[model samples]
Target: MAASSQGPVNGVGEDKTSVRRQSEANRKLKYISLAVLVVQNASLILSIRYVRTLPGERFFTTSAVVMAEVLKVLTCLLIILLQKRGSLRAFIKLLYDSIFVQYLDTLKLAVPSLIYTLQNNLQYVAISNLPAATFQVTYQLKILTTALFSVLMLRKSLSRVQWVSLVLLFAGVAIVQVEQEGKQKETTVSSGSQNYAKGLVAVVVSCLSSGFAGVYFEKILKGSSASVWMRNVQLGIFGTFLGLLGLWWNDGPAIAEKGFLFGYTPMVWGVIFNQAFGGLLVAVVVKYADNILKGFATSFSIVVSTVTSVYLFGFHVDLLFTLGAGLVIGAVYMYSLPKAASPSSSSSSSSSSSTVSSSSSAHSRSHLSNSDADSETDAFLPKSVLVK
Candidate 1:
């Protein structure tokens, strides 16, 4: 009896140790991912703005989109291969099974992939036409759209606070637009051909597409056992094909004259890699951190972009822009806050509260188990609200 008691005590102690270690590891990862996300979000936009604004031969945006897709595909493939412990046979078989054997499922990604590709192209258009700071502030529209779609498609419940946040977000963007229009009129001659109207339209459309594609991708992920990287590979495949088609349609003549990489420069290459890396970084951030932290990173990124724009592009932020940006940032943080436990759920478990508590404790200990890793796909999607 003494020996058995000691054995049980030892097991309990070990479990506690394991849980503690896992928690610490996750905490570190959460912060690291958050940091990287802030940098990536800011840098990608700034770099794109820099490249597009340069006065030399402009690189073909369509070709850049296609190249981004190709690089994304290759990067995802390499990650999957590494996951298979460098086993080439295993990697090939897994790809064949996921991409070929499961052809129907693979085809489902085509819709979102196409939308994503278009959204990517539109981003270039928007950035070229608008100031980096304004674009960043306006791009938060994706969060509002994502929440709306989540309610409609996923039937996800949003707290009252979240609803209010959405309203504030829209109002903020509208204010920014109003101010931007005024500013554009003043600087029209000085600002060259930058078109506020064109950029506004492109960004709005991009936000819509982003919202739909992200939710659609999340729906596919929830019902499947495939890893996020695998789905990315699937999306990448379709994206590459769609991107090439877009390239042919939009920039075929230009490419024929100047070659595929016509105005390619080192900075252009950097932007491509930055875009690709940012896409993959989203997966890691989603895996380690929740949407709330991601929102904080986004909020920080906006601030970074705004500050950088001031120095680099001589962006002038006035009272309206500041007020509007502040509201948007606040909305982002509020929207990301976790919904409080519903009274119904609380009441339902009231009778067995003690039992529930014990079970929760047990779950806490086992939450970092392999099963949790397998279910990572549920959080892997590029969700602006839940997964982003």
Candidate 2:
């Protein structure tokens, strides 16, 4: 009996060890992911700002988005080419059906379309009002906002560590914002605090809208007709039309520039590059990796975002503010960890269900066997003899 018990205990010990190892591996992966995200955001800031300062730069907010969408469609087309090891027409047609196809009637697209426009416009407004450094701060706040919304709006529960991290992250952002504001005051006295506040509001709106978009896109992916690109293509087309209308409304066509075929500038190319590859590189990493890794990749993003904005652009960085930024980033890591829900609980649930099912099956089998035996006995007794 002791030998038998020892065998079971050893088996359980091995199982526990296996689980712990897998969890540890996932944790490390998440950390690596956080660093990668930081690099992506930093590079994006540096690229966009640099392009804007270039000679004959035509990368207005609208142009940038349009170019980006164009590149996405192009990328999709390229993907189709690569995957088309067989019948090209059939494959292309299938892709077109998936992407160019629309499931929702015009009305369904109308509402989200309107909302997307408002969100996009708000982002441009923020970009215009604030510098790269300030914008990065606001965007980085998404991790906190996402967590907050997850708890409050989505009614999701987070661990204590996650909650603490959220608080630390927020504190850090607040500190960074304050420091950045002070620097802004010293450098350019053109606009007052009110403008910064306005920009901040816009940035916040942008973040919230993006978060909402993610939800909607997920919802649609659970179902949509147009491939992600085709869907994006429609969005780009619609957004451009509205943008043109807004431009036309604000100034009338007297100031309208002719020849809008992407303007063919290097900045235009950069926008394409950024959207298609640069930005998506991080997304691809995030998608394949687990949540833990995503947090890890984006862990230093806020700091990188701040540094890239300040240093590369010759902006300011307050030590206290940077410290705060680090705190916020630490919060992101805390938030990203896997929950410690026990495997035993799941195992117990499975066992209970199995017991019930096994009992039911056993009873059915028993009844069937009894009936079979009775039939066999009756057959053994000859029909006429059994009647007596």
Candidate 3:
């Protein structure tokens, strides 16, 4: 009788313990995800800063980009191999079978991949010419451009709050640019105006390309059941091809004169690896978290990068620049908020909650069965013992 009585109690205790364990596990996972994002962002910033300090007439931008693409491809291939249990024959067979369809689908993404590669090169140019903090701040303009592209390509409509946030974002970026220009005027740096103009143009083009590529990539992802890693492999394959073409177009004569990888160095390899791995880290974060979390991560990274730049590179941060950065960060947060709950969504949530409650009640009933059996057994016991 005592054993039966304790059965339900112990079961409930076990359930509670499991719930607590799961909750703690989830909290730890969130922390780990955030740390990955922060580290990746810091690595990217440091790599770019290192690259900008290199003294050379040759940037090796094309070669670095191609190497990054190749790294991505190899990383994806490694993942595939692991998934196939190290069966090279199976991997080769799968690749051969999917070659035609994958290539066709990859071609669709290739155009945007090429655009993203160009944007990547432009980012290097902007960072080389501008302070890291300033470059980071200006890159936030991509959010506004992305919204524009979503409207055009995805037929998505924005709420009034979203539109207001975009406007604030734009204003904030403009203020930062003005502050940079004023500082340039006061410094009397050689070719300051020309370099600033070039940086500004590169930033704008990068934003436009990023917006289009992001929206197009989203569309592709939604249209297919391919895994994220698979899609990345396809993009990397095409990106490598496009990088080769770009290298030939921009550096063919130069390569002939100086040979390939003339400007290569350990630092160059560091930059390439950082860029490639950073992208993979982003994919991992996206797989584990929502876009809202991703946005927060990026905003936090911007703040960290800005502060680090001030300390390490002696970046000037005036009142206007601070205000602009604050506004931009605020806008990003506002933009990431979920839209007002629609009636349909509310109703669905209500139904889901009801279902959950029903399941919980059913589970409780199941647990009470042992107690019910105990009660039945208690009926067979003496009345004095049951009271005890």
Candidate 4:
């Protein structure tokens, strides 16, 4: 009789142990995902900076953008293949069905995708002409532009703190840009000012493209039920088409003179691969993590990039640049603060607990689907980096 009574307690103990183990495993997976995202972002910036140092490369922007898009498509296909249980035929069928069912929705993102292609090319230009640290700091202007676009396109209201953060973001970028200008004036290198001016133009255009593409993509994602991989595939296809057009427009004469892929090197390939894979990692992070974490990742990446730039390229960081970067990082942290729930909303949620429970159940199921997809993708990563 005592043994029978102890049996139920033993089963309960085992169940608790299992739950504790599962929770620990999940925590590890989240940390692994965050680490991968941080590494990817840092590598992306470093690789671009490395590419700019390669000698005798001409018209690398067009070729790198094209190759990156092609790689993105391939990565998307790989994700689809894994998600479809490794059945290429099934994957193709799903692709066909999705095209038919969501073609219009995909088409809606075409313009933004093209804009992204432009932004990609401009990024190369800016990195080539500007110091990597300066470029990274100045690039924070995209956050401001993204906020503006979110307000205008998504009709989202920003809190006063967010608006102040935007203002701080602008001030930080201006400080960095001014520091660059002052350094340019101090240097006697011929065409230094001209190159700096050109880089500024590229950065501004890239910021606008990033802002618009981000808002447009968010709109599409909200309005559609397609998975993140499917949307990325659609964007990749459009980006590749637009990249080809851009190549023809900008590099036609150069291509005719030197032929395609004339300036290819291992470093260029590194840049292309980093660009493509970094994008996929970012999408994964966004799917699995909250915006606050994503913002933290970005801010962390800037710090890593800046430090690596100094050691790898012998880049110098001055007081003004340090101050500006501090301001930018502070602004990012400020923007990432979670909004407080209103009392009315809290009371309503408490009153409608049953309805909320049902909705939460559906949300949990949806979240599980996303997590499964992420897990499948993680299989392609290193064994040490498994999501779960």
Candidate 5:
């Protein structure tokens, strides 16, 4: 009897040790993912802003978008291949099965893929014209759009706080737009084809597309059994085709005269790689981070971008822009807060508790799925790293 008791105690101690190790591992992942996220978010915007503002032969934004798509597809395929234990045969079969065998399901992704491609192109248009700091602040409107679409498309209910946050988000973006418009008129000198009005329209439309595509993607994800990387592989395929079509339509004449890769430079290549890597980073963050943490990363990134912009681009942040940016940052944090669980009545407390426990288990299983759906909507933009 004494021996049996000791065995059980030793087993309990081992279990505790295992749990502690797991906890420590998770904590490490969370912080590391957060740091990477903050850096990726800031760098992508700054790089894009820097590249677009450089005076000289500019790389074609349409071609850059297409190349980014190509790189993304390759990256996703590599990931899926690794998941299949580096078996090329297995990877090819899986891709063929998922992409070709399941034709209808693959076709469904075409919708979000097209929208994402358009959203990505709009990103260059917006950033080229708007200041990086201004674009970052204004781009948070995607959250408002996402929330609205979540309600309409997914029939998801929002809390009172979330609704109030959305209103504040809109107000903040409006204030920033007003300030930008005023600045556009006040400046007499030409700022190298910078058009605040065009940027404003582009960003607003991008936000709308971001929201719809994100929610639509999420809705479809809920019904499917595919992995996130596999879905991305599908998106990359569609995005590449759509991006090329766009390139032909917008820059056909220019490309014919100067080649598809005209004006390519080392800086241009860095930007393309950064954009592609940002898309992959979103999946990592979604895996290791939660909504609240992701929101904090985003808010911190805005501050970093704004401060960097002031030093790098001599960006002047007036009082109005400051206040507006503050509001947007706050709204983002508020919106990410989880809805408080309602308390159960005393009479049925035990039963309610049991039900809640079971439901929470199910929710945890689906948590990653929900986060992935949300991330892709902003993947190329910034919400994900920006476009994610």
Candidate 6:
């Protein structure tokens, strides 16, 4: 090929075009992930809210909660299935061999995932009881809670501006709570007191638990070598089994009665889709993105749930709720400011890289220690570490 006047023929500027295209491709991927996350969370919220409408709702409402738990198991299975077959076997064998790793490696994540599950249930319960918009406002407190846990659990600090914005977010939460108190309405149900009380307690606990889990997952990935999905899959599986066992022991097989064995309906599948895929999507997001950035991405769910409830169900929106939502939105943006890359940030990034390298080395040594025909196959799988 002959050289053109503008360049060293095809070779000269090829790299530049390739670089530009790659950048654009990455940007596109980020946008796609964001879309996936919003849809998933919105579906999840919608399904949970639907539980409130079941006639003589207590049984169905509790069953809905159980269904959510089963979805966690489905998430695990899906995540594991998504991995390379070799990787799955290697990870499984490693777990099978070490009792400590099995407990701390697999089950440890459940503590935090359970926390997240609790928060999620609480949000649904709250929405089921209070005005729909009220739950939206209080739920915005998640950004602040996640931010706080990131600092405490990860020993990662935010900038002063980020802290200020988080403070504003809390203020927003307080504003909504106070406003909702003033606008509280009289209940019509006979056992309104018991229902609302149990619901409120559940909501608060679940939200805090989920918030802590979000922080924990991020920290865990920094210290571990597995892909984001690996850790999440493990956590989801553990969490699902735990939740199912607990709920089954406490309640029974009511939600399972709604399972897709007989002439099932779209509503039932919608619930399954919401819990299964929705749980995985949010879990992946929590694993990959920073909580601050995640807060912005996920806040769209609030809008979706609110619009659906108000227009679809004729729920009322209050002024204080609006203010609270605004605060959360603002807080998400503020926290998302590119952290002024400090020594600490650089150090954390470096440590994460080192952790991956060390884990890789450990995996290589283990396979060599085995020194067999399957060693090569095992070596292909990435190693993982147990992190607090």
Using TM-score, give the best candidate's number: 5
Off by over 4 Å in 5: 1-3, 187-192, 339-388
Name model 1 segments beyond 4 Å from true.
1-24, 339-388
Q: lDDT per residue, candidate 2, 1-388, as tens digits?
A: 9999999789768856865796688568656555555566566555554555445534345544544545654665565556666678977786556535643432344444455555555655565556666676556565565555556554678778877877787787788777767766654575442256667788787667555544443333332333333444444455556656655564344335544443556655754476445543453345335444555555555556556666666766668766876776677667767432342344345434644664575575466444432232222111101000
Models ranked on TM-score:
5, 1, 3, 4, 6, 2
- Candidate 5 per-residue C-alpha lDDT over 273-293 given as tens digits, one digit per residue, 9 for 90 to 100: 878877577666656676677
Tens-digit lDDT string for candidate 3 (1-388): 9999999889768866876796688667767777776667665765676666655565577777788888988987889889999999998876665556566776777787788778777887777777777777788888888889889998999988789989999989999988888877554465342377787798888888777777777765554545555666777777788888998998889887887778777777777777776666555543344335555766787788888887887777889999898888878877876542442354344434644674675565465434432232222111101000
Q: Per-residue lDDT tens digits of candidate 4, residues 138-177?
A: 7778778878988999898888888888888888888888
Worst 10 residues of 3 by lDDT: 379-388
Q: Return the lDDT, model 2, position 282.
A: 50
Q: How does each model score on lDDT?
A: 0.80, 0.54, 0.69, 0.71, 0.80, 0.54
Per-candidate TM-score against the hidden true structure: 0.86, 0.65, 0.83, 0.83, 0.88, 0.70
**lDDT at position 246, candidate 6:** 53
For each candidate, C-alpha RMSD in Å? 4.3, 17.0, 14.0, 6.0, 4.4, 8.7
In lDDT terms, how accurate is model 1?
0.80
User: Over the stretch 1-388, how does candidate 1's per-residue lDDT look in tens digits?
Assistant: 9998899789778866875797689789989988887888888889999999998789999999888778878988999999999999999999999999999899999998899888988999999998998999999999888888888998999888899999999998989988888887766778776888898999999989888887887777655767767877898889889999999999888899899998889999988987876757765666666667877988999999999999999999899999999999999888877632342254346424554574675575365333454354333344321111
Candidate 2 ranges with C-alpha deviation above 4 Å: 1-36, 53-58, 84-86, 99-102, 105-121, 148-155, 190-195, 223-255, 261-268, 339-388
Regions of candidate 6 where Cα sits further than 4 Å from its true position: 1-9, 54-75, 78-82, 85-103, 113-123, 186-200, 216-222, 227-229, 253-265, 282-293, 339-388
Better TM-score candidate (3, 5): 5
* Better candidate by TM-score, 1 or 4: 1
lDDT of 6 by residue, 206-268 (tens): 546545666665555443444444554565565556556655664556546653233234675
